[model samples]
Target chain A: MSDVSLKSMDDVYPQSAGGEVRDYFQLLKPRVMSLVVFTSFVGLMLAPGTLHPFLGFVAILAIAVGAGASGALNMWYDADIDGQMQRTAARPIPRGRVSKDEALALGVVLSCFSVLVLGLATNWLAAGLLALTIGFYLFVYTMWLKRRTPQNIVIGGAAGSFPPMIGWAAVTGSVSLESVVLFLIIFLWTPPHFWALALYRCRDYSRVGVPMLPVVKGPDSTRTHILVYSFILVAFSLAPVALGFGGVAYLIMSGLLGAGFLYLAYLVFVHRVGVEADGHAKRLFLFSIFYLFALYLVLLLEAMVPGMMVPTGFEFKV
Target chain B: MEEEDLKKRKKRSIAIGLMLVGFAILFYAITIIRLGGDVFNRPL
Candidate 1:
């Protein structure tokens, strides 16, 4: 829409060959799917009630497929920008391995299939949440907000953050404050995590005309934003412990992990320019992923291991 | 190139067939699980 021509596969590559299974699979963005599956599994396990193991597996599978459907839809819509960005240039649509129409069909079919299956297997609440996730991603984030706002990742982050809440709803058939807390953790963590990457890849985003924070507001402001969000994220990561869901292990882990995260963020904030600054930003980006994973891992472990949920002696009334 | 495209299309067909069969099985299993022993209690 922004002067970037949306070329179909035939237009770009007249003799382009058909896609293999691998290329079609790549359209789903499996790496992101894996993380979604893991977090949702953790959320399901940590919920108040228990689900049948087989049904639990089905719920996770449906959620993963739904996430993948959104990813495919996103790729279909962003093919124009995808071709311009170095990071996304090799994606199936851009590479002509898969047609944009094929991606759209796959996405739409999978979205309906996953949602219907989830509704049949579990409650409609979980299925509805899945539907909302797919819709918000495709309609709100991808179509509307991404190119228009520097806060794109900040809002688009909700799509990625919904899996755990959906998993929680699948087990309980209701939304609880605990599930909302899990959502907040990821929502707050998204800005800093993405901004760090945007800092280094600012040129790529600007070239593609995507309004990423670093591209729109410059690196200094983006660094300030990362440090601020990192502060809030670190503080909120300890909320589970206060909420009585996370154990003593989680308390200790969150404390240590928060310190490391804050230190990396501080390094990013302090180093303003040059290769040294980019290195710090990259470190923060990588460490942010590990920090969130470790925090969730500790919570998941506490839920799994019996006798591991010792009280931290301070339960605040929330 | 034509031969390669044909091969890929054939492979895609096989994948789709397998996925459809798998979907049917999964739905059947879910229906059975959700119904549980109550399914056996139904009158003929």
Candidate 2:
């Protein structure tokens, strides 16, 4: 649905009974923001430089704001479709907890505030990446790709992947292959992770006309894609070891976790029956979260204690 | 119900607004204090 349709239906849309502070906070999608914070923090820690404690705090804060802004904008724009979907119907905008105008203002305010503060706290490179992440999410993914094609997550995944790079750039003031490998790890992981959810919730997407992979390509095709993406994800997961950003500990942990991830994807692949498919997808989706977190946690540990694990000597300790 | 809802909304929005203003003030103070008298001289 577009702005015109929304305007036409404005009369039918329920007015918010007015919302609480928590309602507005809900618009930020705090769960997703936490992931953003964690990944970006790991990137900051791994980058071979130190930031002023105050400035470091500001950098993380700004990233959080930018992420929240993206979520607000997404909710604002997707409110209509969101109301139709089971999982998202309770969101602020759709549930009349917050108005579209309020959400839009919140997003714009947070986006500008985060970018400006980040630039002041860090450097132009990190700020620029932050700006791009916000723009890509609001414009490229939410507005354009989401409703149009099944490949939306494939490309839109880049938005989520940028946080770590922004964190890297915040410290090093440049992007390198090391930060990029981190980006690749998440980029490859998104499809399998999201497609698993889509496998279970294809009906929700179809009802909203969002053209998610399972809805557009059918569940079997989506499963195949999930398995293929899982293979790539496992490969990318171990790339940190090969690329020299991860040590033996990282390699061992990632290899073990990657094998587990591949097995879940295989389960998702083999299960064709409805209930069985949903079960596999649920398992895969949950495990994928753990898989990525564990990979990054190992890297963070290696950075904190180089004695524990030595990343491949891809970059020198600057 | 409507009256109570309206009151709750007013209180919530006001609280958030105040919180945001405070956040901004703190941010500005940190930047200004850290940068010292030369804060304005340095380009943001």
Candidate 3:
């Protein structure tokens, strides 16, 4: 059985020199890595203790590499669909810059290296979480959920959400409610954030048969879902303050950002399906990226700075 | 590739290699300091 499978794999890939270092790097999806690193850093900073700076850097690097590995694996699996979408058409595997087998090999190697290095340099707990992140991303999100349902991003968001918690675990070597809140913030933010993009890119998704909310349910229904998720995201953003994981800086930033996000969602939801609706959806998509980055940046700053006051009435022990 | 072109490519490759080595060393140095390593007791 093993020999048969190995023969089939070799047949599928043949032999190619396409898996150069640069091509492998392209598989990492650097933009996504940046977000992963930032959120993981915030989680580390917000954790109750300090790591040696070098160790902290190593931990973050490991997490970033793990994220990259996941991206590589995702690209390996999604190469077919990716080729069909304009936004993803130029990716290494789909463009034949790297073969699917080469991409898979790079991903597997990096995944093992990262998880092992993290376990040795940090702790088993962080290592385990990293493993879970990779597994969930590959198995639960990519393989099972991505093409199966319109609720894909909602569930798949958990894979992206793990970084902060992994960062926290790197420091504290344990899970906490605070880390979970950080996870929730990203989780709830993902649906509307992605759905907005889906609204404008609906045709691309439909062409590829990806079953995204907009493609599967029509733009009107997708608009309503975006509004619903946006409202939920706002609530989740404010929950950190109520949960005692954030300070005044975070509250004020999140409040203002949440209002902006809601307004964008409102526009996307109400605008008639035409050029105007497309423009509104695109605006929401762009702002969602900024909204998340700003939200997390404020959280990191608040955690780093001393004597930043939080709301008085808000308190949660766990 | 021509001989002159090959020479240029080799030079470019060497330069890139050197730059990568320098960056790796710098990264290691910064990481060691950040991780609270004792410079004097550095591992061989």
TM-score of chain B, candidates 1 onward in order: 0.82, 0.80, 0.74
lDDT of 3 by residue, A107-138 (tens): 89889978876776678999999999999999
Q: In angstroms, how far off is A182's CA in candidate 2?
A: 0.9
In what order do the candidates fall by TM-score, top score first?
1, 2, 3
Better of 2 and 3 by TM-score: 2
The models' CA-based lDDT, in order, is 0.91, 0.88, 0.85
Q: List the residue pairs that clash in candidate 1.
A: none
* Number of clashes recorded per candidate: 0, 4, 4
DockQ of each: 0.82, 0.49, 0.12
Best-to-worst ranking by lDDT = 1, 2, 3
In angstroms, how far off is A34's CA in candidate 3?
Answer: 0.3
What's the distance in Å from true for residue A114, model 3? 0.7
The regions of model 1 sitting more than 4 angstroms off are A1-10, A13-17
Error of 3 at A80 (Å): 1.2
Question: Which 10-residue window of candidate 3 chain A scores lowest in summed lDDT?
Answer: A12-21
What's the CA error at residue A267 for candidate 3, in Å?
A: 0.3
The interface root-mean-square deviations, each candidate in sequence, come to 1.2, 2.4, 6.7
Query: Could you say which candidate leads in DockQ?
Result: 1
Model 2, B1-44: lDDT tens digits are: 68889788789878888978977886886677558788768667
Candidates in descending DockQ order: 1, 2, 3
Q: What's the TM-score of every candidate structure?
A: 0.96, 0.92, 0.85
